[model samples]
Target: MRSALIVWGGWNGHDPEECAAIYRRWLHEDGYSVRVETDLQVFADPAIHELSLIIPIYTMSKIDKEPLANLVKAIESGVGLAGHHGGMSDAFRDAVDYQFVVGGQWVAHPGNIIDYTVDVTKPEDPIMQGIPASFPYTSEQYYMHMDPSVEVLATTTFSGQHAAWTKGVVMPVVWKRLYGAGKVFHSTLGHQAKEFENPQMATILRRGINWAARAEA
Candidate 1:
């Protein structure tokens, strides 16, 4: 059976613990053996190298350098990495290697949280096929520092919420990247547990997990 190691917990302000639980339940129901943990050191376990996927439900936490390094190595050797919003992107701010592998960093959500529309740029991708080309949701409108290597699959344009100079900006909301021998998928949604209950989001996330586990090149 495929295994997923979920590491959840960090600033409660981000509600990662609750979000992690939501994912644990989702994956369990989907028939994957899932192990949930709050610590970051599990990356050091040689056994972690055997897992098919690793989900980081952690946001803005200081990770031990050793384990962080080990995680990079593990994924480099072929382990899928997947997560959404701050839980994945905001986990290790000071670790360049972490950001290097993950492919982006959260910068700001200019007008705080607001309703926005997501446009699927890659409708043929399995994760996006059933999803409508455009949909509206009330959540954080993320401004990210994206990597050039990532294939952006979805984007959201700033909806004129503020009279700032950046009003017409469009940013990636979901993307995928091949890092070393592993795969990485990130969606800038899922700021709250309620968001995960969206059928579209659930299907997108499920496909992302499967995509990340694909055989390495």
Candidate 2:
């Protein structure tokens, strides 16, 4: 059986613990041996080396270098990595090396706390396959610092609320990237637990995990 290691908890405001529970249950139903941890040491375990995937639900903290490096090496060797919102993007903000390896960093959400539409850019991708072509929801409209090579699967257009260089910009909301032999999938929409509970959102998450974990095949 494929194993999954979920490291959660950094900023409680994003409800990483709650998000971990939701993911744990979903993945368990899918038949993965899952473990939820708040400690970064979980990354260093040789057992983790055999796992099929690693999902980080952490936001904004420096994970100790040794273990963090261990995880990076694991990902580089083809273990799957997947996450959403600031949990993955804002995580390890001070660790430039980690950010570089992860492929993107959360810079700003220009039009904060507003309703916006999320459009599927590559609807044919496995992650977006079952989702509606377009959908609307009330949440933060993210403006990210992204990697140019990312395969954009979904995006949200921003009609800026206040004057800034990003005013009237169309930005990627969800994307995937290949890091060495591994795969990384990210979504900027999971700022709240309710967001993940959306039917389309859940389906996308499931498919994304499967796609990211595809290397095991």
**How well does each candidate superpose onto the true structure, as a TM-score?**
0.94, 0.94
- Tens digit per residue, CA lDDT, model 1, 9-113: 887767788888877887788677889887788888888788888999888878888898899988888899998999998888998999999999998887777
The regions of model 2 sitting more than 4 angstroms off are 214-217
**Pairs clashing within candidate 2:** none
Residue 129 CA displacement from its true place in model 2, Å: 1.6
Task: For each candidate in turn, give its C-alpha RMSD to the true structure in angstroms.
Answer: 1.8, 1.5
Cα lDDT tens digits, model 2, 11-111, are: 88788999999889878988888888999888877666667888999999778878888888888888889988888888988888777666788888755
User: Candidate 1: misplaced stretches above 4 Å?
Assistant: 214-217
Q: For candidate 2, what is the total of clashing residue pairs?
A: 0
TM-score, candidate number 2: 0.94
Clashing pairs in 1: none
lDDT agreement with native, every candidate: 0.85, 0.81
